[model samples]
Target: MTSIAAVTLEVADVAAAERFYSAAFGLGSQVRLRASEAATTGFRGFSLSLTVANPATVDSFAASALAAGATSLKPVTKSFWGYGGTVQAPDGTIWKLATSEKKDTGAATREIGEIVLLLGVDDVKASKKFYVEQGLTVGKSFGGKYVEFATAGPSPVKLALYKRPALAKDVGVPVDGSGSHRLVLTGTDAPFTDPDGFTWESASSLTPAP
Candidate 1:
């Protein structure tokens, strides 16, 4: 079973990024990587998604993120698929807070039920194939539109892929840029890049050679 052990984001100010993410998403501040000022620019080609139990939870999470310094990209709305919204974190990383279906829980919920890292790929099919070759099991796939992989572990963050334009539209951003996506995925295997240039690093391969 392949599990995503860690996801690293390159940030101009690691300390500030840490604070924003922690306060906004309830994520800890220990998972950030400091990058040189010259390395921070443009879209990172991905978005982090948090899936809660219901619509009220989604709204609450979105509001919390905004209060924590996130810029609203898309206001919360109910669509055929579900209820959700998009926000850009202080470090320029896009985030989507959503729920797949409406529930009558009738109470405000604040806990995040799941997390996902959605990659914007130039070619969805090709990128999906590359990840499959890397030993990830496919969960749900929508041909060239979207694909989700199943991960087995404590972290609930799943890996997914969507076309660049479609992803940009979902996150309310433009689909062109050049800069480190500022993302790092760690697994229990060798490091590799997908067809779309997204890097997956090995959890056990972080040691520097002597």
Candidate 2:
């Protein structure tokens, strides 16, 4: 199955954004940074989720992000599902660090299990259909509420869809926004835009701007 090969975040300062990412998440090449000044306000309509091993790991990441200059939108807390938190990076990207495991089983490491790209779409069913036509198979679907795409290949990022308002609530932000999402995904083959206006480009073309 096709997976998102990489995600590119367009930021105003490539140098600062790169440094922040290195210190905050150390995402390496799984995320690429590019230079862009596209006008954006309110919520950006998406979030990058980091799924870790346990609650301790979540706390560790949350601390690391704050120490690296990210503003905390939600403190690490335990919910019925698990423990998690939300932070907004200096570049204006919302990142959710979470784990389904409520307790720690071992020492906390910077080991990230999966990086999920959560796109907040206007229409879940429509966006799901658009991605399906783009050759992505559905791994999980929750009616028109949400959807997840399978990733059996080398792609590192898991893709999912959620209602925009719900996602914004999860991030503790308003759903209203304008201009670019400042995000770009490297999909399986050709480049195209989804029904929600998220762009997917060829992997070879996803390198950081020079």
Candidate 3:
């Protein structure tokens, strides 16, 4: 299985945007230039690699993306949690950027690891059965319509299921199935939402405990 590492975002200008992030979120000064013109920047634990593109290229991509139905939003500003940004793709896909310093070391260093996806299912029973057949051990039921599933492998990932309506109430959101939810578990794990709509979380501490 192809496990996820870090989600990369296409930014306007590497240095300017990076500076903005650093000042806005107090990010670290560490920045690395890849073989390409792109630069990889790091914060405390997570990293943001700004791939530089020519001005013309950026304009062209933006135009093409907007033409294809993409809507771009300003990056995430100061929030109760941290700093981040957002963008809507041509296919109505949404992307977010945030500065996370937490690292996933273990139980001693962190609690939950990797990304946690809250999925809304039309049929909880059917979805639960499908995941169970796939080898995932379903954990305790949160309530009547919510449950937790844990899988052990190279990287531990958690899949939390909630009734669409129930999840909305828990998160205090209107509950749009198409919305994106990004989460950082523990300290080092970088779990993110995949383009295919399946939430993916990766973590070293996610393995089962003895």
Question: Would you list the C-alpha lDDT of every candidate in the order shown?
Answer: 0.79, 0.89, 0.38
**Per-residue alpha-carbon lDDT of candidate 3 for residues 1-210, written as tens digits (9 for 90 to 100):** 222222223343445544443432222322211112332221111112111122232233334334444455543344554433444442222323333422222222111224334455666776677555544577657544877776445433345666667644433334444323222232134444332334434545344321
Among these predictions, the greatest lDDT belongs to 2
The C-alpha stretches of model 1 lying farther than 4 A from their native spots are 29-33, 36-40, 205-210
| TM-score-sorted candidate list, best first | 2, 1, 3
Can you list the residue pairs that collide in candidate 3?
A: 75-85, 76-84, 76-85, 102-187, 103-187, 103-188, 104-187, 104-188, 112-186
TM-score of 2: 0.95
Per-prediction CA RMSD (Å): 3.3, 1.8, 14.8
Best by TM-score: 2
Better of 2 and 3 by TM-score: 2
By lDDT: ranked, best first: 2, 1, 3
lDDT tens per residue, model 1, 1-210: 276777777777887877787777777522445564646455678998988888888888788889989899999999888889999988788989988875546565677777889999888898888788777889999988899999776644788998888888889987877867778777757788777777778778554211
- Candidate 1 local Cα displacement, residue 156, angstroms: 3.9
Superior candidate under lDDT, 1 versus 2: 2
